[model samples]
Target: MSQIPLLDLKAQFETMREEIYEAIRQVVESQYFVLGPVVRKFEESLEQYVGASHAVGCASGTDALILALAALDIGPGDEVVTTPFSFFSTASCAYKVGARPRFVDIDPGSFNMDPEKLAEAIGPRTRAILPVHLFGQCAAMQPILQTAAAHDIPVVEDAAQALGSTYEAPDGGGSGHAGTLGRLGCYSFFPSKNLGGFGDGGAVVTDDEQLAERLRSLRVHGGVQMYHHEDVGWNSRLDALQAAVLAVKLPRLDLWGQGRAENAKRYDALFAESGLVEAGAVRLPRRTGTGRHIFNQYTLRAKDRDRLRAHLNEAGVGHSVYYPVALHQQECFQELGYGEGSFPEAERACAEVLSLPVYPELTPAMLEQVVETIGRFY
Candidate 1:
């Protein structure tokens, strides 16, 4: 009769309530809500943490994407190559800027954009390549970066689920943080994200100082000075309160990620001992082991996924599909002429992928119960 939620935000907040409240109180006392000193401090701290030269705070993760696209001057006939197996905003950002989102199939093992298939997708109109760090694991960035560099296309790392994740540099120099690996990296501070704020907030990180300045200007309606328009941009400022809350939580992020990683390892061991892998009933997530992978969500490929989901629900376990439909097959993108089997890997993932409760706050007993319930179902 034990009930487990998919993400226990309350449990996490309880541990840091006093510190979080104090940060909020300081912001409230300043009475400067939008794009103020607190937000600037958070941006500087975030830039340093991500190993980027600049970080521009924005309204939300979705707004971060739009701002990135806009700042890059991607519009009209430009095309962006990206995976079909992600949240709608991944592709929708391209659409928002009046550009085309060229979809590519994902690697079934990683559930990320296939790097080998990327070359064929790039064309004359392709302006950028967006490789999402889906499920908190960095994608195959080496090959993807090579392909993008060869074609002279900018790469945007959609690190929404991968704030603290790291990947081995393509050139073998050393380890690089997820958001610092590409031309522009976007992050989310949604209430459910690993580094969740009190509400909606996001940021774009980049090494290019000029692009960073442009992103900053774009977020504040494209103005270098107040009311002086350099370009047509939208209002997308990250609030000071959210920034303060996030800054308070920022120092503890790596420890939290380590907890999630330990839990993931425990689940792997538990599943292996339970014979689920041998029985071919459930497939665990594959880790490249090249760099740090913050387990934002521990997803599995379940045979008879729908039935398994039902059983988990009946057993008081919380679960849900990360994406039930590939972005290419969405109704809004039907004009692109993609059918059911356009991206087979992504489509199959949509049908079978189930994200379990992998939050950092989960206890060993909770994880075992989750695994036992699934084992019994299969």
Candidate 2:
């Protein structure tokens, strides 16, 4: 085997080039670069797809978080509870809005904030609870929602990595998409994401009418009426050009997600057939609840991860670490008073998780090569 890249956006673009180019051409002809009809149409499409009452596009996923925090009026002297295992923006968004970020541990299986730990972390000053949908699986939202509702605290979901992931309602009501399970859900359209656009873009989805209105206003300098500022905000509007591209790709998202899921299942079968799981050499990703897991990155916990990564590279297999360090342990967050053992599970995860090539574009031959390469590594 020569090599298998971690992700191949080129392959995806090849199939949708005509549609993408035409959408961009339409945007150029319309002469609208910022939020306009194109953006509004995309937002409506996203709202219906995600089953949310409202979807507000923005500049980036990080901005989406800051907007959600600002829209909810969570600021100084307030605290937001979130996991230490996720990307920086997951916790930094709270800090950006002048709120303290209270850290919690993660579930070993799901790599998401442990709902059990969240209950003990909430305090009188806890203004919001943010849970990240890590990798491509929805976090345990049911318990998290119940905990937040018990205290009347809002939950902002960092669904940046879980665009099409689903979570079934524990009450047997029905299936709920990743972001819609909370007060607000944030998504990223970064070039590397599963539903990535041509460039940076993001959005905040919500079922609350008032919150959605606030978010829409907040994304554009907090002005609902021209030049009239209601609340202090930032310049985070999503570009119309990017929206056009996203709109063209939106219809194919479910199909692409299914491809990723199929790839994940293949990995499971291959690894199991090799007896890697039982040998204690590798731990496969697990589905924590009854939900449609859209495998954004099929990551596994390998023994001697550092050695395995080096060996994979030597074998011409492309791989990457989702996170090499936990948030609490980051030097920038030292002021938060978290030390080495603040979040043991998160720390351990940072050292062991390795994401393999699982992009929808990967062929069966590529998948076989990746598995065989890793199997030989042991």
Candidate 3:
């Protein structure tokens, strides 16, 4: 059997060798590393792609979320509702600003924040609803928006895992993409994401001009001028080198995302017929009702996920558990007073969910091997 490792980024780099080299060389030729013309151009192009009036480049995804919440003045004694099933950074960002992260169980199928649960979690101290578009699909947005609007709280989208994901509005006219539906949308360009860069990079996108302006100022350490600081803000800025790499990669995101979606479809079909579905040993990834599923990780819920993971790895198929520990169960958030049974679904998912190799570059033969290996285990 071939030693098929997960996420062969070197394969992608090899395919785009000349273009990447040229982009890097161009950035090197121009000595402006911090917030240079390339960075500005990337920001403008990203804003245009998302239909946002502004895009403020930041240092990382966590910082992007923190800055967005901080810009909204949600701090100390305030609460932000979010799910516990995402990357630790989602809740960590809220905590960074001294705001408590209120947990809500995720929708089992979508793996996103359940709107009904979100509505139940809101209270007088709830400042915003930080809905994460987890694992490449957008969360249920219209209902979340309605709930937030009723309480006059903003929606800060954690779009780190979803750049191409879209939604259909109720009226049928404003059917648009993710990262633009909320008051402020935060995106990550970490090397593993669909829209990735050479290194850590992130952005805050917004249609509101004032919010956009505040984000811009915040990215630059709260300074509109050289010697003046309008407010306290972190030193978060997207460097030019990562921007240049992302500028080269952005055009290919849609194509790569489509490839991932196709691979996911193949996995769904293979798994269904493999007797796993009938035997109730495993379940498949969710294809969102309105938009696409990019198969960021091709996660499946399996019985004894850790043991199953060991079986697959022994068969030379690489895999991962996106998050084996839920936030409330982690030691960091014990102060929130959430004990063992606080969020059962999230805890269950943590122990049962397993991520298989699902990059766009994966061939059908490789996918077949993955499914076949899992079948052998079951």
Quantify how close model 2 is to the true structure by its C-alpha RMSD in Å: 1.0
Off by over 4 Å in 2: none
Worst 10 residues of 2 by lDDT: 169-178
**On a 0 to 100 scale, what is the lDDT of residue 104 in model 3?**
96
Question: What are the runs in model 3 whose C-alpha is more than 4 Å off?
Answer: 170-173
Query: Please, what is the whole-model Cα lDDT of each candidate in the order they appear?
Result: 0.93, 0.92, 0.87
| Residue pairs with clashing backbones, model 1 | none
Report the poorest 10 consecutive residues by lDDT, candidate 1: 169-178
Candidate 3's error at 4, in angstroms? 1.7
lDDT of 3 by residue, 41-82 (tens): 999999888788889999999899999998898999999999
Top model number, lDDT: 1
Candidate order by decreasing TM-score: 1, 2, 3
TM-scores of all candidate predictions against the true structure: 0.99, 0.98, 0.98
Per-residue lDDT of candidate 1, residues 25-92 (tens digit): 99889999998899999999998898999999999999999899888999999999999999999999
